[model samples]
Target: MGFSKLFIFLFILQTLLAMALTQPTDQKTNIFREYIGSVSNNVTFADVPINPNVEFHYILAFAIDYTTSSSPHPTDGKFDVFWDTHNFSPSEVTAIKNQHSNVKVALSLGGDSVKKEKCYFSPFSVDSWVSNAVSSLTKIIKEYNLDGIDIDYEQFHADPEIFAKCIGKLITTLKNNGVISFASIAPFDDDEVQSHYLALWKSYGDIIDYVNFQFYAYDKGTTVYQFMNYFHMQSSNYEGGNILVSLTTEGRGGLSPENGFFKACDMLKSEGKLNGIFVWSADTSKGLGFRYEEQSQALLAVSHLHSLV
Candidate 1:
């Protein structure tokens, strides 16, 4: 071939290569973009095996303990209260990032056993609490490069109006600062709670990205199926797809993933209300030394269903 022809061919090949390089690879998916995934079943610096085929969209790490009293220590006394990003070095965060590149890591703030007083009490009086939370969250995100924040405050009944307003403000502030914000709320079977709070959440839907409904811990007065039916019935009224339903496998008043959780997901999917599933905490179900294999299997089952769909 002539030298000019060879040069032209090389230029075309280089252009093709440049285009391929600019395109995103399948492994490095978008993080800020919404997707389905599991909550981190093991929050500690342990070897947690994540399914490669199933994209782990969100992995929530436990940070501050907003509970009223001191948290309970395991037999080893490893994960005590006051455990946050400060306790875990940069290496721990790096380990999680390495495991799942597409995962959005959000730091959770409260737990079910938390005392109402320890929560944001100024929700009724001052708006500074929102600023304080935003400041702390921004610091954490800057430090660890997290994707967003998850508000796990369990004191929903203390001051619903002020609490919702504070949440709306916090979410708006976070979004304005280029961060995503989500809240975990209690599930309702009757219209009593929903009548008051559901409207508030709907009104502020533009600010809040998603809401993880705690469908467990409800009164299992009847069979598990009956309880799940009641939960589904309540969720029917609210906007469906944006809601994430969480199930607990082991706790004082918990439901097994096999019976309550899987069934609940199936029910939601049938009604076109299922968005995703989030386990309560890594320590409670899989992190602690009990029923690890069972929880793993349950998670695998969910992942498998996602694959088929």
Candidate 2:
């Protein structure tokens, strides 16, 4: 009887150990991201304070697949640097990453506009566009020493399937070729945009890392209650993806930080649903002394510590 009891005890101990090892730990992946150099206000990585406790990413505003000229036009899938390269160059990226071991730099693709014209996906064909995009973006990613890519195409001339295939293939190729370690999709709540991104999410949700939903693109004066509802909606739409909370430094729209944005975040964190926070444009933030940026990092840092305990 004692031998049988000892055997049972050992089995129970092993099962308990496995359960403990498998429990989820989210503290390591908590992140704080910001977009910079989009407005050309001379904002560099050094201008933003880096918090050592949180995983921080500096997204270079845009590397649009368009020609650079007085009147820019799309070049099928070829990308050119549209951000403030003089202020945020390859050397600067290296310097910042070297300075902060937790820092990573990624480039955004297909922003809202290029030289006043609406930027569209406008790919000739999925195969050709993927080919050109892979080649051109590989060059730019290498040149900038970037770690990832964020899709921010605001408009699309192509159909939803075409957009999905083109982007899904591009991200797959980049990851397989070891070009990028992470990829994200930025989609707001517009009907057309939703259709296209939802198609992509359905097909490639396993590969995409974060849904940087433009929460700030919503109407101004959003209440904390409404914000929480919207968060649940997008979380359901994207399903298992990490839906990050956002606010623009421009205060152009969405839930303003001064008006209880952090309070909503606290609620999500308490529920273990808060993934991360991203701010729009570090350019406008410089004038505000980056108070919101500091607050965001501090929140993530504190949450990380709490998770450890």
Candidate 3:
């Protein structure tokens, strides 16, 4: 072959070989970019973009107490009656489903005030309460197509054993029909309550997908030190699987997302035992309540932690 032809041939061969080696790496990079783009686009009021590599604890189905006394009450104006007909708006529920497809949104049944009234009846009660609850929830699921249900039966403090049985029944029924179930539990600080908590956990573990610890009420402070102490204590005590550490972004002495909340999440990630993070209510942020941008930064901060894996 001529010298010029030989030189051209060698150069072309080298270029082809280099392109072949780099193709897979370049394709992977592109795929990752696309995946991240898809996730970012999916951000909504209910969920923030989580790192695809890390499995996030379930994003709480931001709850609004639809009972009688809530700001926007149903026409009947009775807590139980109102709950039967009124629930979250279709748009609000849609926002949750769109934002976090993989995450579960458990409809929290009761709130602090709801518990005070002793409104929750036994799970075995043949009263209209269970039927009403199930019907209301079914409407929500059908309308918003929620991933799961969260029974926040705070009223059950008086008779938690019976309450637990009721909750277990509800959970079993939901799971058998292919729905997820989560239970939002009070803090287990006292020895007596700790025993009850353990019993409930043991009994409901099969039916309950996860337990969200109301960590904020127990650990009210402005610093990471206080939050961490509370978190560690709870983790040490509760040796259960998929225990989610929760905090409130609003309400009495709640932690702001920018404050120690993100730091606490990082701390949990470092420990290699973090399941997920839950914000109390989406309706109660400082300025832009539950909007994507306001919550996005907080989620991004959690996603950035290298130790999340």
Candidate 4:
């Protein structure tokens, strides 16, 4: 072949190799995550049953950028622990992880409301918010020995780009500093919320580890067919992302386990799309006897084993 032809061939090979390296895989994993501490249910880490077969994660419900005083006001970018420290303290985090070898702990940021007022992503500026967030969150993560962080800012006081820049920078800084091993964004199907998260995904998707889409936030009577379609829709929305299937123990919304959540999970598992599963909270599950938690982990474990077969 001529020199020019050889150069073209090598370029095509390198392009294919890069595409193979960058593309996301659909391999299923036996990973289960749950949000704890947000509901202030006096629930402790030990209360939840742990399945050793699955990689379990207990994500503390929230560490909001707000004050924990009586009024509970926002602090621009500064974050403070708003979780149920009475039961789920930093020490509890350490104890749980130490007890369960397959367990990891993460914290979510910006829950729905604070003191009846909406918790907005009202960062004063991207630079300042990221700086304050990094400083405050790093202290909390180190103190708790947490493994990851989740973004759950439901309401946004800023535009899409501003929200994107603030969160994108925050995740980037935390990962770069080795403060956290993984990070996730908890986005629901709302138009406004999706816009902001999509903006973040568009800009810094490579750095993001997971898209913890809140499918439970959908209407309460969602069917198995609707659930599967929703999952596919979101899979398309956040393309090439490990979107975890979610449910709420509070019976608030989405497809309840009694209504075929695990069945949907089994379907996803068969297609190798069941990357992971997470729940809205451990707080409610504690009162409900944690049967669904047991079921979820069992399904994930069985799915993992079957996948190997």
Give the better candidate number (1 or 4) by TM-score: 4
- The candidate maximizing lDDT is 2
Q: Mind giving the per-residue lDDT tens digits that candidate 2 earns over 1-309?
A: 599999998887777555433332343346889999888777789999877777888898899888755233677788889999899999999999998878889999999987887788888888899999999999999998999999999888899999999999999999999999999999999999999999999999999988899999999999999999999999999999989999998979999988999999999999988899999979999999999999998888777666654
Top TM-score prediction, candidate number: 2
Window of ten residues with lowest summed lDDT in model 3: 29-38
Clashes per model (N, Cα, C within 3 A): 2, 0, 2, 0
Residue pairs in clash, model 2? none
- Give per-model TM-scores: 0.64, 0.90, 0.60, 0.88
Clashes of 1: 2
The digit string of per-residue lDDT tens for model 3 on 141-162 reads: 6565555655444434335565
Decreasing TM-score order of the candidates: 2, 4, 1, 3
Model 2 ranges with Cα > 4 A deviation: 1-29, 68-72
> Model 1, range 196-291, lDDT digits (tens) per residue?
356557667555555555565564323457656655665565554255555554453445554555665566556655555565554454444434
Error (Å) of candidate 1 at residue 259 is 3.6
Task: State the C-alpha lDDT per candidate.
Answer: 0.48, 0.88, 0.46, 0.86
